[model samples]
Target: MAQARRELAERLREGGSESAALEARVLMEAVAGERDPDPFGRLDPDATARLEAFAARRLSGEPVFRIIGEREFWGLPFALSKATLEPRPDSETLVEAALDCIGDRRQEPFSVLDLGTGTGCLLISVLSECRAATGLGVDLSPDACETAQHNAVVNSVSERVSFVQGSWTTALDRRFDLILSNPPYIPTAEIATLDVSVRDHDPMLALDGGADGLAPYRIFARTLPDVLAPQGIVVLEIGAGQEQDVIALMTQGGFAWRGSRRDLGGHPRALIFGYALK
Candidate 1:
């Protein structure tokens, strides 16, 4: 097994994979269908075939997450859809921020709305922490919406969570006490420069935040506040170096920039906002 992993790792490294060892381990475990202490041990023909296929896909620049079909976020496993954007560790920062902002409301029967809810990670994660909270997750892609629904079931929150297919906040007439979004924030030019794992596999609809990476924020600034309940706050994931610009856009859109949150790398990755109560 060690030998197989080494060979796979060599293949991945030669293919420009920065996380070759990690990717190799992930693929081996996935193909073996469980955690095997001795990964190099003999495998059934079926498992061996699966491992080769998985390795080939990885060598071609496909993400291990895409090949594995799920990612863990907020300490919970979320299934991916054809149109779903694989959840990232950085995205967990937004979940932490939302939980902090809604500290006292965690146990309350509050409401949440997640715009551009891809795998429903944001809404489902937040809802999991808030036992009594109900949420509506909206996305432009119906396929993504369905995945979110399944994710809700997987996390045991489906009873309190609902999925919708539509643009941000358009399908619902009600306001929520908490709004969360990890919208597309990569600029058009930046998209091409992204690592192959992202640029090639992630659905473009979940990326492409327009020329400046602030296009969705502009739409968010204009639309989100209207769906927020009195005193409710919004938590949005943003691209690196977009902190001030996003704050400015929200301010101009009639929202008060409450605060921000940083990811593991200390990048200002999430912006908090609230309606100005005009």
Candidate 2:
């Protein structure tokens, strides 16, 4: 165990990362009896081989989340796959803004629609917050839909959330009291410049925003009017520089900007728009 830790530490140092040693330790413990018991008292050779494979993948530019098939968001563990984008902390602003807009608990349950749902993080977080809320998460990828379903189950909200495979609101036939999305808002041209963790490992559909990084918003603006119940709210996660453009599209679609929420880093990250009549 000591020898393996030392080797992993040296590998991490060469990779310019400090967390490698801790990860290796945890993996080693997991393989051994400390974290979880194995068939053998000591670490299983097969498990150690798997750990080496994961470490090699991580070293070769794969994200740790992808290698582990899970990510932590809102303090909950969410299962992830190549089909969906990894959950990011910045998107938490969507949950906060949604909670603020939805207000105190209601006697009647309200429905939420999540477009481009990836790993069901946003929808599941909102359902976790609003006890009276049921949500439907939509994604174009079938794999993403499965991943979202797995997340809903893991978060203990499967009964309150449904995952559907389709683009935007195409598969949604019911109206929702609130809609939220962390759609692809990065301009297509800028995708190549993203960090290797995102550019190489994350799903392209979750990152590419077409031309101006506003295509999804445009589609949402055009489609939301049909599915949003009267007086409903739409909360969207926007690119660092896309607040105004998203607001403009929402305005053109007859939705009015309620407010914008900044992320922990103070970048304008979430935009809340409500029906103009509201």
Candidate 3:
């Protein structure tokens, strides 16, 4: 195992991986089916082959989580599919903001709606933290909706959560106390310029944000009001430097910017909003 790690690390380093040693360790542990594998343990022939395949995929610009087919969000595991975006740590700001807004109401029968649900990470994570909360995750892709549903079950939140294939909030006939979304906020032109791991592995539907990259926010501004209950809160994950642009769009739709939360990088990544009239 030590020799295999050294060899994999060297190959990844030569392939331009910045965190070759760490990635090598993770990949090794994954193949060994444990978080803490015995460094002296021997890999079976099949495990060795799988490790090689995973390393090759990573070297080809696939994200480690993408190659593993799952990612941890808010400390919960979420399965990924071609139609779904891998749950990212940056997006966890939305969950934190949502839970903060739901504070005292956490134990109540809170209702949540996650737009562009993807792996249902946002809604599921919120539901997991707020034990009595129920949530609905909506996405345009049937495969994404299916994958999200499976993730909810895996997270033990299926009974409190549901997923649907639909556009934004159009299919909803009721209002929700909280709404969350990590929409595609990347400009169409910028998609090609993104890191190969993102441009090549993430679904275009989950990355392209139209010509200006704010199309989804525009739609949410115009439609979210109708689906949000009075005094309800909406938390959105925005790209770096998108705070004001998104705030302006939502403001035009009768929503007021409440505040913003920064990601680990200190970039304003989560925008909080509430009905202007309320």
- The candidate that achieves the highest TM-score relative to the unseen native structure: 3
Worst 10 residues of 3 by lDDT: 63-72
Stretches > 4 Å off in candidate 2 = 1-3, 18-42, 106-108
Q: Which pairs of residues clash in candidate 1, taking residues 3 or more apart in a chain or in different chains?
A: 1-40
TM-score of each: 0.95, 0.90, 0.98
| lDDT (10s digit) by residue, model 3, range 1-278 | 98898899999999999999988988988899988688888899999999999998988989888888888899998999999998888889888988888888889998999999999999999999889989999999999999999999999999998899999988689999999999998999999899999898889989989999999999998999899999899999999778999999999999989999999899999999999965
Q: What is the lDDT of candidate 2?
A: 0.84
State how far residue 256 of model 2 sits from its true place (Å).
1.0
RMSD of 1: 1.5
lDDT of 1: 0.89
Error of 1 at 148 (Å): 0.8
Predicted structure 1, TM vs. truth: 0.95
Task: Give model 2's TM-score versus the native structure.
Answer: 0.90
- Whose TM-score is higher: candidate 1's or candidate 3's? 3
Give the top-scoring candidate (lDDT): 3
Cα-based lDDT at residue 48, candidate 1: 76
